[model samples]
Target: MSRPHSVVSQVPSGVLVVDKAPDMTSHDVVAIARRALGTKKIGHCGTLDPMATGLLMLVVERATKIQDLLMSEDKEYEGTLTLGVTTSTQDRQGEPLEEKEVRSFAPEEIDAAFGVFKGEFEQIPPMVSAIKKDGVPLYKLARKGQEVARDPRPVHVTKYEIRDIALPEVTFSVDCSKGFYVRTYAHDIGQHLGCGAHLSALRRVRSGKFTLERAVTIDMLKTAPREDLYKAMISLAEISLMRGA
Candidate 1:
């Protein structure tokens, strides 16, 4: 069999940080970015559910070499939690599968529960995730009307705060290790509250050293030339080499 090509052989290496717009899959953004950069060596650090938006890391050219390392970096998200409902997708993107009475809790109660999520814990990933089981994405199997037992995986929530608490809606922020699923966390928290809930919205604000403030929108990318786009891309290696202050 012929050997697979490496990203190193495709083009010069660099990383593109994009502010992925809502409703567009990470792959869709990569496709447009590939065209914008005029090269095929592009790859993304991690997968973001289409309904979620914000910073998305893209590796271009030989820099795709660092994709694995970058994907391991911790992530930060500002997500909104909508109580009183649950969904198959675990987010607003999915159909409502169940509803429960909204329970009013004091800010201290909400904060305490959120505190329970902080630190290392085992978490079951959402069935809607892109994780592959036997070479098939879990979501694909879910769409086929199949359910499978999945083992809980360890993930760390370094910081989880209830920025705002409301009976029917809660806004919060979290910083978690790679492989952590905010969607699953939201659902689990709702369950604990005795009032089922799901993620209403999610926006990743940071990944490693890359922040959402620098993300380029699709429209902005559409009008920018490959040359300009190339200039904006940052390399993961550079980010990794930086010393923490």
Candidate 2:
């Protein structure tokens, strides 16, 4: 006869808000959480690019059921775009493809160009993205020196504001619907400005009702007491409340 599982091995069902560090993939966070929490029943609501950092919602145990619903919610991000440079990946990770002189522009000019991006528009998903083509992720093909034609995807940019600008670099925030790619947005803006551009940095600050303020870092999970770690978990009941919010 086999022995039943112990209570110590079974963690409570809930969501864990994580402050994902730069260079770590979403799956990397999930693997670390599995070991820290002592359970393999862990999953994430959305995938963040390795170069992007910030709030990542992880569903643990029975909380995994709501992953799809959570992923479908709108998201907010803040990042800096570097003007006068274009990259193959649309971000700093890729090799520089082109460079142009950064020309002077008024704040109003920048705002007017951004205004054109507001509301609904069609965007081509970046080749460095996880979007699949022919059963393989586009990034895989990108790594092999391959480029494929992709259809433009409709994306809604509810808000796009330039917070600050220092010539070659522009810092901005965006509130956009799911499936929107901020890297593509930056690329498009650069094209409109006639100077080219690429995403230099990105941080996801919000997802659905969850925010980075409530997230815990990997270091915290590693050093906190087991009881304290449990305290950080958001129960599924709490998540259900967000459905109406």
Candidate 3:
């Protein structure tokens, strides 16, 4: 049975850069897009945590062909982490597993902590992540309180800068290869600082060459007319230009 407003033939196929709102899964955005655009052929290049916000690339219709290529692109993010507190999910959304006193650290000290992780390295993804184990997602096992060994995967960070430094909270920006978990980076950096920590907040600002400059909002997706959405979409020709073809 075709869903309501089924007009797959009416809309031109391309990419939509969404300025995703917090507290919603990536799938939630796609579901809304499917209804708003009145088409089922939609997918996201990357998945964002429910607590995350910012640029989320939605491949619509024929644009789904380049989803894998887009997914493999390096990513950029701005995030904050709280020191002296570690959570089960390595983020504020998770259970507070432990907490300790957060003492002051010199800027050099913090820089030294982030310095070691700037280049190529291996990172063990958080158990709450989307990684697979035995053909089942690791998050599913984490729900059952199961802990399993996971081999670390190689990752590369092109750049990172400390934006703010205050006791218990730090803001920073990072550009890294695909599959790099910013939460894990925070956790490991906490270990380097002799204080455990968890990601307090996160926002993706860029993916590959795409930025959040013209991204549409959730409200726009839900309330705007389909014609308006098509106006904001990146045409296939534009994508080809970005690819230097």
Using lDDT as the measure, which candidate wins?
3
**For model 1, what is the error of residue 202's alpha carbon versus the real structure, in angstroms, after optimal superposition?**
0.5
lDDT of 1 by residue, 115-191 (tens): 87889899987888788899998999989878777889999988877878766889999999999999998988888
Reference-based lDDT, each prediction: 0.82, 0.89, 0.92
- Stretches of candidate 2 exceeding 4 Å from the true structure: 1-9
Clashing pairs in 2: none
User: lDDT rank, highest first?
Assistant: 3, 2, 1
lDDT (Cα, 0-100) at 162 in candidate 1:
80
- Whole-model lDDT, model 1: 0.82
Candidate 3, run of 10 with poorest lDDT: 1-10
How well does candidate 1 match the true structure in TM-score terms? 0.91
Q: Candidates ranked by TM-score, best first?
A: 3, 2, 1
Q: Write the per-residue lDDT of candidate 3 for residues 80-114, one digit (tens) a residue.
A: 99999899999999999888787889989998999
Q: Could you estimate the TM-score for every candidate?
A: 0.91, 0.94, 0.96
